[model samples]
Structure formats: structure tokens, C-alpha cells
Target: MRHALILLSISATSLFLMSATPLQSQTEDAQSIRMNQVGYFPNGPKRAIFSSIHKSDTQKHFRLIDATGKKEVFRGILTKPEYWKSADEWAAIADFSQFTQAGLYVIEVQGGVLSAPFQIHNHIYEYALNASVRTFYYQRASISLDANHAGPFSRKAGHLNKSIPYHKDLGKAQNARTASPGGWYDAGDFGKYIVNAGVTTSLLLMTHERFGSIFPDGSLNLPESGNGTSDLLDEIRYELEWFKTMQDADGGVFFKVTPLKFAGKVMPADDPSLQHMIGKSTSSTLNFAAVMAYAARLYGDVDQSFAQQCLQQAEAAWQWALKNTSIRYTQGTKSSNYKDVQTGGYGDQHFEDEFLWAKTALFLATKDSKYSISIDDLPEKYSAPTWAQVSALALYSIILNEESFAKKVSEKAKVMVQQASVKILKEVMAHPYRINQMNYIWGSNIVPLNAILTLSFANHIEAHPVYLTTSVELMDYTFGKNPTGYSFVTGFGTKSPLHPHHRIMMADGIEPPIPGFLVGGPNRGRQDANSLKRYGGYPSQAPAKSYRDHTASYASNEVAINWNASLVIALSFLEHQRALSIHEPK
Candidate 1:
């Protein structure tokens, strides 16, 4: 693959730290600095800042030190202190974009604060992107990961279902195991869920749609790299193939395929539990409908027959959803034999979001008037595209599409985009870390990530520098610069989370968790039992201060397919922007 050379060169010499290095003990006046561990591209937008917990004015200069941690690489002057009224803290900004030399460097504050070393290069994030995408490959089930094909992460085939049994509601089960072979594990658990797949697949497709030039054929170094399609599309199709098998003859899709109980901490091949295909809810069916419809369009040029099949399945699911609109896949009632509280339920009471999303996809795919009416009628206020909330996704697809839309639908999209942009800007200004209250729930890191999508859409509608800057601040808070003083992404920063709640990382004896796996960031809710048992005693209820880096802190430490998909979208957007900068006339 074209990107492999760049990735290998950087990662070949990288050290896999077994644990996080402790931050230097803070003096009363010490200032804490934070930035992404991989640093910025030499020609890209670059900014980092120092946080002062005391809210005291830090009238000090900072320096960038070379790899030796002794030689000064660049000197930096501090900007005027900005008071954050919400957290009662002060932050000072630093911009060293003028220092364009490609090398490893660390930020050093005057009073004993030293940042983790980072690099500035043309392809610094190529490796991060590769590692992030490879996680999906690592999660592929029912396929033998040959050493020659999978490299160091090779494994035997798992979950090879020769036949599948339909739930009692659907019909009698198939006697022979139907092959639902390859798709990602939804999260830490070994479940393949359609609801989560809907968001994850769309984000990956968005990368190809928006940044197709970046990923040439053979760019991702996957086993299918040499295939006619782009590596990104190939990886997405690998999962889509499995998704095709998830639909019943009736056209409705199952919620997930998983064991009767959550598997223990074990390797994919070693988890010897029988997999069950369960749940046929409107939410899952509509989500399946949306993804399949959009994917049909994506696959049209590559494989027309498969594209037609996807559209057919999508239309089928849409029809099934209309007949059974109100059925929610409650955890315990979805399956008769297994009332799963152990695995992800992905259940939602509201179907309007799913309805609008499926309608948008159908409208775009076929230009059907029936679908357009519903698209125009979609509620103005809807949740961002979370696992349970996906109305924003429909808006994104509508806004990004070049096809003509009804005046009502177009006006609705613009209104939604502007309202979301304003909400994010207002909240970011109110908070010290620039993260909003919307991100204070479980898997909070994804909120800012989802906002980036919204901001990107808003940027497309009208070029707003504040929207882009706010997006950057969101990146800073996510990568580092938060109250926890740790980079939420594993294997990137000096002070990154080492113990994420990922089963393979925990049980596989990996030194650090998988590179580029973004941990669920600060969550004040602390809803998971694991998190409550470990960190609930902490007195601080401030949103940013509620995170812990332990593997048991599922609320704040678990990694998910949908979250990483969001990261991929953000990273690809930055990469695209960096490309634009590089090509600009001097």
C-alpha cells in the first residue's frame, strides 16, 4: 500500500510504552501544556495552550525542546491570559506554526511543565489513520487472518455460522448455519450490531466521498489492497457483505449477532460461545435501510449488481419499518432465550430520527417523491448522530448531496446546521476546556467529534473561521488539554490512557492498548457499574474532571467502532485541509 511506507518509517522506531509516564509534580504556579502527541503537519494549522488551574496570570515564555529534551528547538511567547468563567481557570495560548522543521519536539513551560514529545511531518497522521482503520480489520470475525495477509495480528477463523436461526417473531430458524462472515465487533464485546454499523459505515464512506484523492488504490495495506477498489472502500465492503446476510427474507434486519451471554475476556478465536442472530426492531431495520440505501449509491460505480441488491434490501427494510414503526428493541425482551444486559442493547424509544434518516437515504437514492415529503417533514430539533440518535446524519447526507432538494427540505437543513453551529459555539465559549455539556454523557468524546461533522457542514454552507477554530479546540480537548491531563487516545501521547476497556487489548497481553484506539472521554454520568465501582468516590462532579484511565472505567475508558469512525472523519478532514494548504500558491 502507498501509505504503508510512510507508516512503517515512523512506527518502526516507535517505543510501545507499557504504562503512562507520570506527569512532573506541579509546583504551586506550574502551568500544564497539552497537544496531540503526533503534532501538526508542517504546513497545517497549529496551536497548543497551557492550562492554569489557579486562574492566575501566567506571565511566562515557553520553549520547544528537541528529542534530547535539552536542546531548545524553538522559543514561544505566551498570549494574554484568557479567563474561563465556568471552571474558574486561566489559559494562555501558544502558536509555533512558524517552526516548520520536521522533527520530534516537546513543549516546555517555565515552571517544570514538559509536554509529551510530538512530531511535525508531511504524513504524521497517516500512521494514526492506518492504525485506526486496522482496528476494524482486527475486529473482523469468521475469517482466518493469515500471517501473510494479516501480518502480526493474524488469527484463526471465528464465528463461521453455517446456518442462522431466525427469532420466533421472524419465522422458523434455518437448519444450516448461514454465513454472516466478516464485520467488526461493535465494541469491547464480540457483537456485530446493525445500529452501530449504520453510523460507522457512513463515516467511512464520507471519507472516500470527501477525500478520495488521498487514498489511492493499495493505500491502506489491507489484505485486499490490490483489489480494483480503493482500500477504504474494500474494508467497508468487507463489513457490508456480512450486513447483507443479516437481513431476513421479510427485509427487516436483526439488531445484532452475539453470544447468548457476553463472552469473557478472551481472543476472538478463543471465545467458544454460540452466536445468536437476534432483534428485528424498527430502529435496527431503519438504520439498516439508511446505510444500505446510501451504500447502494456508493457501490453503484464499483459493483452495480451488489449496489442493486443493497438498494433492494434497503427498500425492503424501509417497507418492513413502516409496518412495524413502534417496536423498540428493549434489552431483555428483544430475544426470548437471551435477555442481554451484558452486551450493547443499542435500543432507542424514538423512531423519528431513524425514520427521517431512512427517508433521506431513500430520497437520495431513488429521487422518490414519497421519501422527499418525509424528509421535508423531519423534526427541526433532533439529537446528534449517536448510537441511539442519528437524525443529524440524515441532515448531513441531505446537505452534502449535490442533488436538488425541495425548498422546504433545503431550508430545514440550513436551519438545523446554523442552530447546531450556534449551540456548539456558545457552549465552547462558556467552558474552560471548550467542550460542551452535550459531551458530558457516556462516550462523551464522540459529541465533539459529531460536532465536527456539523461544523464541517456549516463550513460548507458558509466559510466560518470560528467554526473551524472551535473544531480545532474540540480536537485539543479530545486529544489532550482536558482536566484529566491525559490524551484519551492510546499509544499517541506521553500521558495517554494505557488501559482501555477493550477485551482483546486487555487479554491479548499487548504492552499498550492498540494504537489510535480513542477511549471514551470524560463522563460525569458515570453510568457503568465498572466506572461507579472504581471512580464514583471522587468528589469532583465537574464534567471534565470525571474521567479515569482504568480498564474498569467503561463509561470513560471503553473504545467503540462508532467513536473511532468519528475520529476517522475528523482526521480525514484535517488531512484534506492540510492538502489544500500544501497546494496553495506561495
Candidate 2:
């Protein structure tokens, strides 16, 4: 592959201790500093957010204090605080990128404010990257988890899904059953949805394909950790195998395996809701075709027989999508929480992107123009990939595997990625937090990461250093560098989300939520109850500040595989960039 990146071997990363939620000892000081809570890289960019300081015009200074707070190894002047409209807060930035030493340290402001400790190292993000990837293992549906692998989060497998019946719309007998099993739960709920899985699964597979060295075998501590195969692939194969069952005899893929409504906050084994096929759509079928083709190419060497099977499945799905091209995911059962909207409905009426993606992926797998889309057929605009809109996924596939694509198609793909990258780069530069706008809707956290992913792809399309540097800043925004000043990830920071809106963490009797899961961050819309049950009101109505750390605040603090997949790949790509900066010495 022409786009094959230089492989970087990884060392074992040290464990990050789980700090007490809202660390009582440093609660007041913690608010004074905002940065990547995990740490900064020794040679990478180092910046932090400082607020509510400055005794005199000339005294706006911050010091890098050792973990003991007794020694000041470095000092830097704070930039003037800039007013950010979204959160209506003044934030000052301190740049200390010149400090290339590796150590644990904190920041000290003028008014006796201090930050929680963080590290500076070459492999600063390796552990978080591994954790983000391992979160998939925790989400596996079917089979029990042993303590050796799952540790404190071990649980008996639920959602056996051996005999899920089809809904009446499928025109099957009332007693007919199809067994679809062994994929991660889609979100905080117990639904196994294909429409959402389309973007999530493909991204994971792409990450593994591009950066295979970072996720070496046994790195993720999966059940198949040491099976002499990439643990990430082992995990992805489980989902792919489940995807195999999702395809009907005629090749259409079912939209989701879900009950009429979502389950309550109960353990997976105890969720009483019935699991069955909701429906199928053109979008889902095309998505299935694209991923199957992608899997066939990536897994060809790992499992020749399985790769051939996937290629066949991809062909069948392409034929099905050709016939059923306009099917939207309009059929959804009733849910108590949702009234008119389709519960768990990945409402997408647009199938052009889906069509292009399926064609591009099949082309990559087969190198056949019959399965390829012409550059003239592309949409005029390109956007960052979401489950609903994945035109970029197709373009990215063409861009990454340029050798397998026609020069015109490859150039067009690069132009599309760069077009989207320009918009995101402009926004990243304009925002005070070094992000795009606070798209603080449901799953708003993934917005910046989607930008990060696009920027990375654009970097691949045209190797510009600024593309990747901007991408890292967006990643920093997700961790703890944003207006919220909270690491949205469940367990990697000094003050992380303690109670994400995940049913398993709530019902599993665990005092701490599992590590590596990125919670849905702040949403301006307080659509969920303000003070539901044990949860309190959101801190503020400000779009950037409207977040609660309560399990009941599903509007803001929820976990989903789709969102986590973005986080995993962003971390992996950033780590790859860091590795290149080290080993390549360019």
C-alpha cells in the first residue's frame, strides 16, 4: 500500500490512578487550570488554560511546579484572558512547549491556585489510546467476561440473541427467528444497531489498517489478547461476525437488533427487554456492503477464507442496495422517551453518500471500476463523517488507498478532504478553546473529534504539518482543554466523568465507571429532565457549560460505541503522529 505509514513499536504504559471524583483536596484549584489531564508530550506542543488570576498587570505569571509543589522548574507568562461567548468565560493560555523535560508536574497561578498533577513523556498517550480501544471489549454483547481480562468490570454475558424474531414488516412467520449475536452494545442502552455501527465499525477497521503497529497483539488485553493476532482485529472480528448474521438471505441488512423500547438502568444480564430485528433500509444495506468490502481487503492475509466470504457478502449487499436504493430508516417501534421520532432510528433519507461509500469500498477490495464511483458523480460539498452522513468515509477510503484508485478519483478525494479540512481548520483557529463551535447537541463531544479525524485524513491527502498540529489541538479540546474543564473520558483525568449515563456502569454495582469510555459531553439543550431522580440540574444553560455528571443526564453524559470509536482513532492517529516526530527525525 502506498499510504502504508512507518510502523512504530510501543512500550508498556504505566497505569493511571483513578482519582476521587471531583478530587476534594484540589476542587478549588482544579478549576483554575485546564489542560490535557493525561499529560503533554515531551517534544509535542504544551499549552494550558488559566483563569481568574493576575494581581497586577505585570504579575500575570504561572509556574510549572513539581509534584511536591516545592520546586519551580520552569515559568511562563500568561496570555491575556480572552472572553469566549459560548461559556461566557475568560480563559488565558500559557505556552510551555519549550520545556522538553519528562516529569510529573502541575501549574501554579498567582492566587495560590494549583492544578492536579500531570506527566510529560514520549508515550504520554499510549495508555489512553490502549484504554480507548479496550473499551470495545467492555461493550461486547454475548459471552461472559473473565476477571483476568475484564478485571473489576467482569460480568455474565447477556443478550444471547440466538433467536431474535423479525418484526411483522419483514413478512416472516410469527415464529420465524434469526440469530444475530456478538457485537458491542450501541450506546448506554442495550440496542445493537447497524446504522450507527456503519461509521463506528469502519473507523475502527481503518485505524487498525493504517496504524497496525500501535495496536500490536496483546496490547488491548482482550480475551484473545495473546492469540498471536492483533487484539483490535480480534475484537473487530466479533462485530464483523455479528454483522455477518445481520444480512438477510437476499442480502439486505437489518437496521437494528432492539426491543420496541430501550431498557432501563439494569445489568445487561437482567435487561428484560426483548431483542429483535427492527427493520432494514437502503442505508444500512449499503453500509453493510461497504464495511464487508473493507473487511475483506484488510483481513485478506489474516484469514483468506473469511476474507473471501466478506467479499461475497459485499457483492450481495451491493446488488441489494442497487435494487432498494431509496429505503430510509423510517420504521421504528414506540419508546417511552421518544414520541414522534423513531426510537434509535438513525434517520437518514440521503443515500448518495452511502452509495458512493459502498462503491468505493468494494473498489478498494476488488480494484474493479464496476464497483467504483466516478469523480464527476461526487456531491458538491463534503462534511465530517457522522453515522447519518458518511460521504467523507468513502472519500477517505479513496484517498488512503490511492494506489488502488484512479488518479482522478484519488485527486478528487484529496480535494474533498481538504475542502472539509479548510472549514474545520478555520473554526479551530477562531474558537478560543482551539475547536470548532460548541456544537453542544447530543453527543456533542464527538464533533471536535470528527474534525480531528477529517484533519488527519486531510493530512494524509496532502502532507501539511499544520493539518496535524490543528488536529492535536482539537483532541486536546476533548480531553480537558475545553470550556467545561472536565475530561469527558470516564477515568483518565484528575476530574473525569464519574457517573456517565451508561446502564452497565450504573447497574453493575461498581463504585467507579470503567476507564476509556468517552461520555457524551455538554449539550446546550436540556432536553432530558433537569432534576431527574437522584441527578441534579445542569450547572448552567450556557451551551458549553450545560453538563451534569449524573447518570440521569443522558442528554449530556452518555456513552456510545460510535462516539468511543472516534475517540479511539483520534488517539491512535495522534500517537502515530507523535511516533513519526520521534523515530523519523524529519
Candidate 3:
């Protein structure tokens, strides 16, 4: 037992010596002092440490501590790309080495009357060889030690330019100038007109319900004019009034019209040469009325009597369309009306079937059984109709409160929605040169059609993967790329500009105008001296090409409006579905 005690004592002494050795060595080692520390703004022209400390609620403060124990602080601000060009600056600081403890240090910042603190820590390298490799690697990448020779560290600096002065006097001059009004403008640019009106009305209605305001100025700003909320509403009101003026005594709208002149023209009626054209058929007339029904509802609160009159006119238009179904003419083997020749037989007819969309909208407004019958009869004509046509039928079914019918159509539509992803891919491959513009056969039309179809099928069927994918692609293509700029130059080539009248006109005081008035000249075959010069003295002078030049000839204004409106509606529905999904029982 005595021998065991002696061995235990020796072991205890050795353990105590080992434990106390590090503590004694830590105090005896020469202390590394920090010196000549500096700080500056990020990317700034100058490099100076004006103060020892800086502070801000939103900004992060950085510091460099030297071997002599002196420290400098840096104040930085974050900014976006647009702001970076005009505002923010950068700064470089001296080396820091004295604060190399393996623990966090809280450094205080003095902001005149305020103060703040930030914590920083020192990292140790377990493998010096790896550390040397990392240092060499960074050096090879054009990053190395500064004048202080303490660090080869890289940091991203985000700062706002506080030095640049702001001026309010130049605000008026800074406003974007309006383009010249000439060349081809929308005579009856129906699609865009309707789509704009529909989106405007829907947004106004939705916002009014939430905020008790007729227009939400904070949210809706005009892209071109940069107009405020009130200005947008006034613009919408002006357009509605213009549309009202274009209404015929029979309650039907003309196929096309010039909004500025308030002159209405029925294509075949006004131009005898176009009487044989398939686009001039009465089905287009019915579609116009259907659009009018929704417009009437939107403007109803403002003019109830006029709104009621529009609904009645829509009913009459539907009746007229049904009666004129048999009026057939010839454009080659393809019948001008009644029969489907494009897809062979009427098994997948959608050309004139689009008229059913108006029928559905009108039925929703009036709840007429005839509209319901017209919609139900669609399946009898086509063995398996397209999602676009069936979606329209489903919408009508929903209006009739026929849940079963809606479910049936919605199921079919859901499958088509899945097909949309593959369909879009095919569309891209089919038209490689101008996938966004020239390939109207399946490009622009399919996108919006798919959106509306998906919306119709939303609750009745499972959400289609293509619904989300195609919608995003369409929005990106339309609002981001195509509409802004990327349109085809028509009239100069064999292909006539799609609905030449719908393009916004811009005058350059040049003659022998180009197709789109917004970017080129009048393009009405009138050659002037200025136009010749603008065309670079080419033997055949033509106008410049812009994306806004393309228009849907079938019903330009209505189609555009409907497409955009459908997008708005679909988005709203999707949001509502998401909310429901979140709140649903787990």
C-alpha cells in the first residue's frame, strides 16, 4: 500500500506540471503587437482612415488590427446593380495580425452621438502546408497581401454613394419622352386592347375589394408613360369610352376600328375585296360581343344602363353567330366557315371554336341556357377537343354551375396541360429562326391558351406540371423578351405585318414608311426624301424593325386583351389555390 501511494504521488505531480506548462508559456511568449491599421470606403477613389470607428444599423463594420495593436474600422453599405453605377464606393485597409486570438472579439464603433459593436474571430490552420497551398492559389488568382503584408484575404464590399448629391430641379426634363405618333397604329388592335382592359378591370376590382379604393396607384404603374396610379385609371377610362363609341346600333362591335378617329369598320363590309377572306367571317363579330360583355361588367358601376345594354348586345351576337354557322365559302379546300380543314375533319377544331370563349363569358354574365347548350355541343363535333377549346367549355360549365361537366372537361384539360411542356419544346424546334414571333402557328397562341385552360382545370383536376412551367416560359418570353423588343419586320417582306393597324405608330418625319409606326415610318408605300436617307440610301428603302410590329390579324385588340386578362386571372387563381393549400388540414 505504501509503494502504491508513492507511485500515485509521482503521477499526480507530473499531471500538474503538464497542465501548468501551457499557461506559463502563454505569458512568457513575446506578445505580437498590432500597428498601422487603416480603413476606407468600398471601391472609393481615396484610401484613408478618417476615424478609428464607424456605426450603422444596417451596415456591417470591418476592422484591420496591425502587429502594433493599432486598429482601423470600415463602414460599408449594400447596393444593387443599378445603384452601383452611380452611388457606392470602395476602400482598402492595412494588415491586421495582433488580434489573432482563437476567440471572438467585440469591437465598438463610435457614430458621433451613437455607438455599436461587432464580433470578429481569428481562425487557426491545423496544417501549415495546406495553408501555404491556399495562399499560393489565391496569389495566382491576382489576389495577394497589401502594403501591410498581413493578409491575402478577399471580401465583397457593398456600399452606397453618400457623396453624390441629388437634384429635384431636373425631374421634369428627366421624364421619358413620348414616341412620335405615325406609321402603323392599332386601327382595331383588339387583342392588346381587350387584354389591357381586362387586366386593368380585374386588377381594379381585386384591389377595390381589398383596399376600398377604385384604383391601386401604388401597385399599377404604366410601363410606357411611367404614369402614376391615377393616370393609369384615367387611361383605362379613356379606352373604355373609346370602345363604347365603337359599338354599333345592333349592339355588335365592328371587327376593327381606329381609337383616335372613333371610326368603325367591318372588314368584309367596308372592303369588298376582303369579303371572301376567312378572317372576315361573322364568328369574329360574335367574339367581339363576348369581349364587350366583360368590358360592360367592368364599367357597369360607372354606367349601369350602358353595361346592361352591352350584355343584351352580347346575347344578340351569340344568336347571330349560331344562325350563320352554315355560311360556307372557299379559300382553297379549306371552308371559309362551318367545317375544319386544317386538322382534317372537325375532330380537333379550334379555329372557329374560339368563338365559344365569348359564348362562355357571356353565359357567365347572363346565365343563358342557350350558351350552355352551345358549349355542351362542342364535344359532339370533336372526338377529343384541344385544351383551349375544352377549357372554354369547362368555363361555361362552371358558369352553368354544372360541376360534373366541369370535372369532365377539366380532367381532359389537365392531361393537355402535361402535354404543354412537350408541346412548347416541339414549338421551339419547329420554328428555330424566330421561335417567339414568326411561328404564330403554335407559339403565341398556345401559351395564353394553355394558361386559361390550366386555370379552368385548377380545382377539378390535379395541378399539371406543364401549367407552372409553360406559364413561366410564356411570361418570360412575352413581357421580358418579345414585347419589349424582338418583333419581326413585316410589309418589307412577303409576309404582311400581322394586323398592321394594331401597331403603335411613331413618326420620324420620313416617308415611304416602315411597318410599325412606333419604330419606323408610315410604310404606306409613300417614298419621301427623309425616308430614303434614313434607309441608308438602299435601292429599296424600308423601315426599321421592332418587336411591337406583330399583331394577330384575326382579332388583334381582343386577342391581346384576352390573353393578358387570362394571365392575370390565372395568376389570381393560382395564388388562391396556394393559400388554400397552406391552410388545408394536415
Per model, state how many residue pairs clash: 6, 0, 45
lDDT of 1: 0.73
Model 3 CA lDDT for position 397: 35
**What is the C-alpha lDDT profile of model 1 across 533-556, one tens digit per residue?**
645443346766677777677777
- State the C-alpha lDDT per candidate: 0.73, 0.80, 0.30
Instruction: List, residue by residue over 96-133, the lDDT tens digit for candidate 2.
Output: 77788887777777666777777788776766787788
Give candidate 2's error at residue 316 in angstroms. Answer: 1.0
- For model 2, what is the C-alpha lDDT against the true structure? 0.80
Candidate 1 clash pair list: 162-177, 162-178, 163-176, 163-177, 163-178, 164-178
**C-alpha lDDT of residue 157 in model 1:** 77
In order of TM-score, best first, we have 2, 1, 3
**How good is model 1 by TM-score?**
0.87
User: Top TM-score: which candidate number?
Assistant: 2
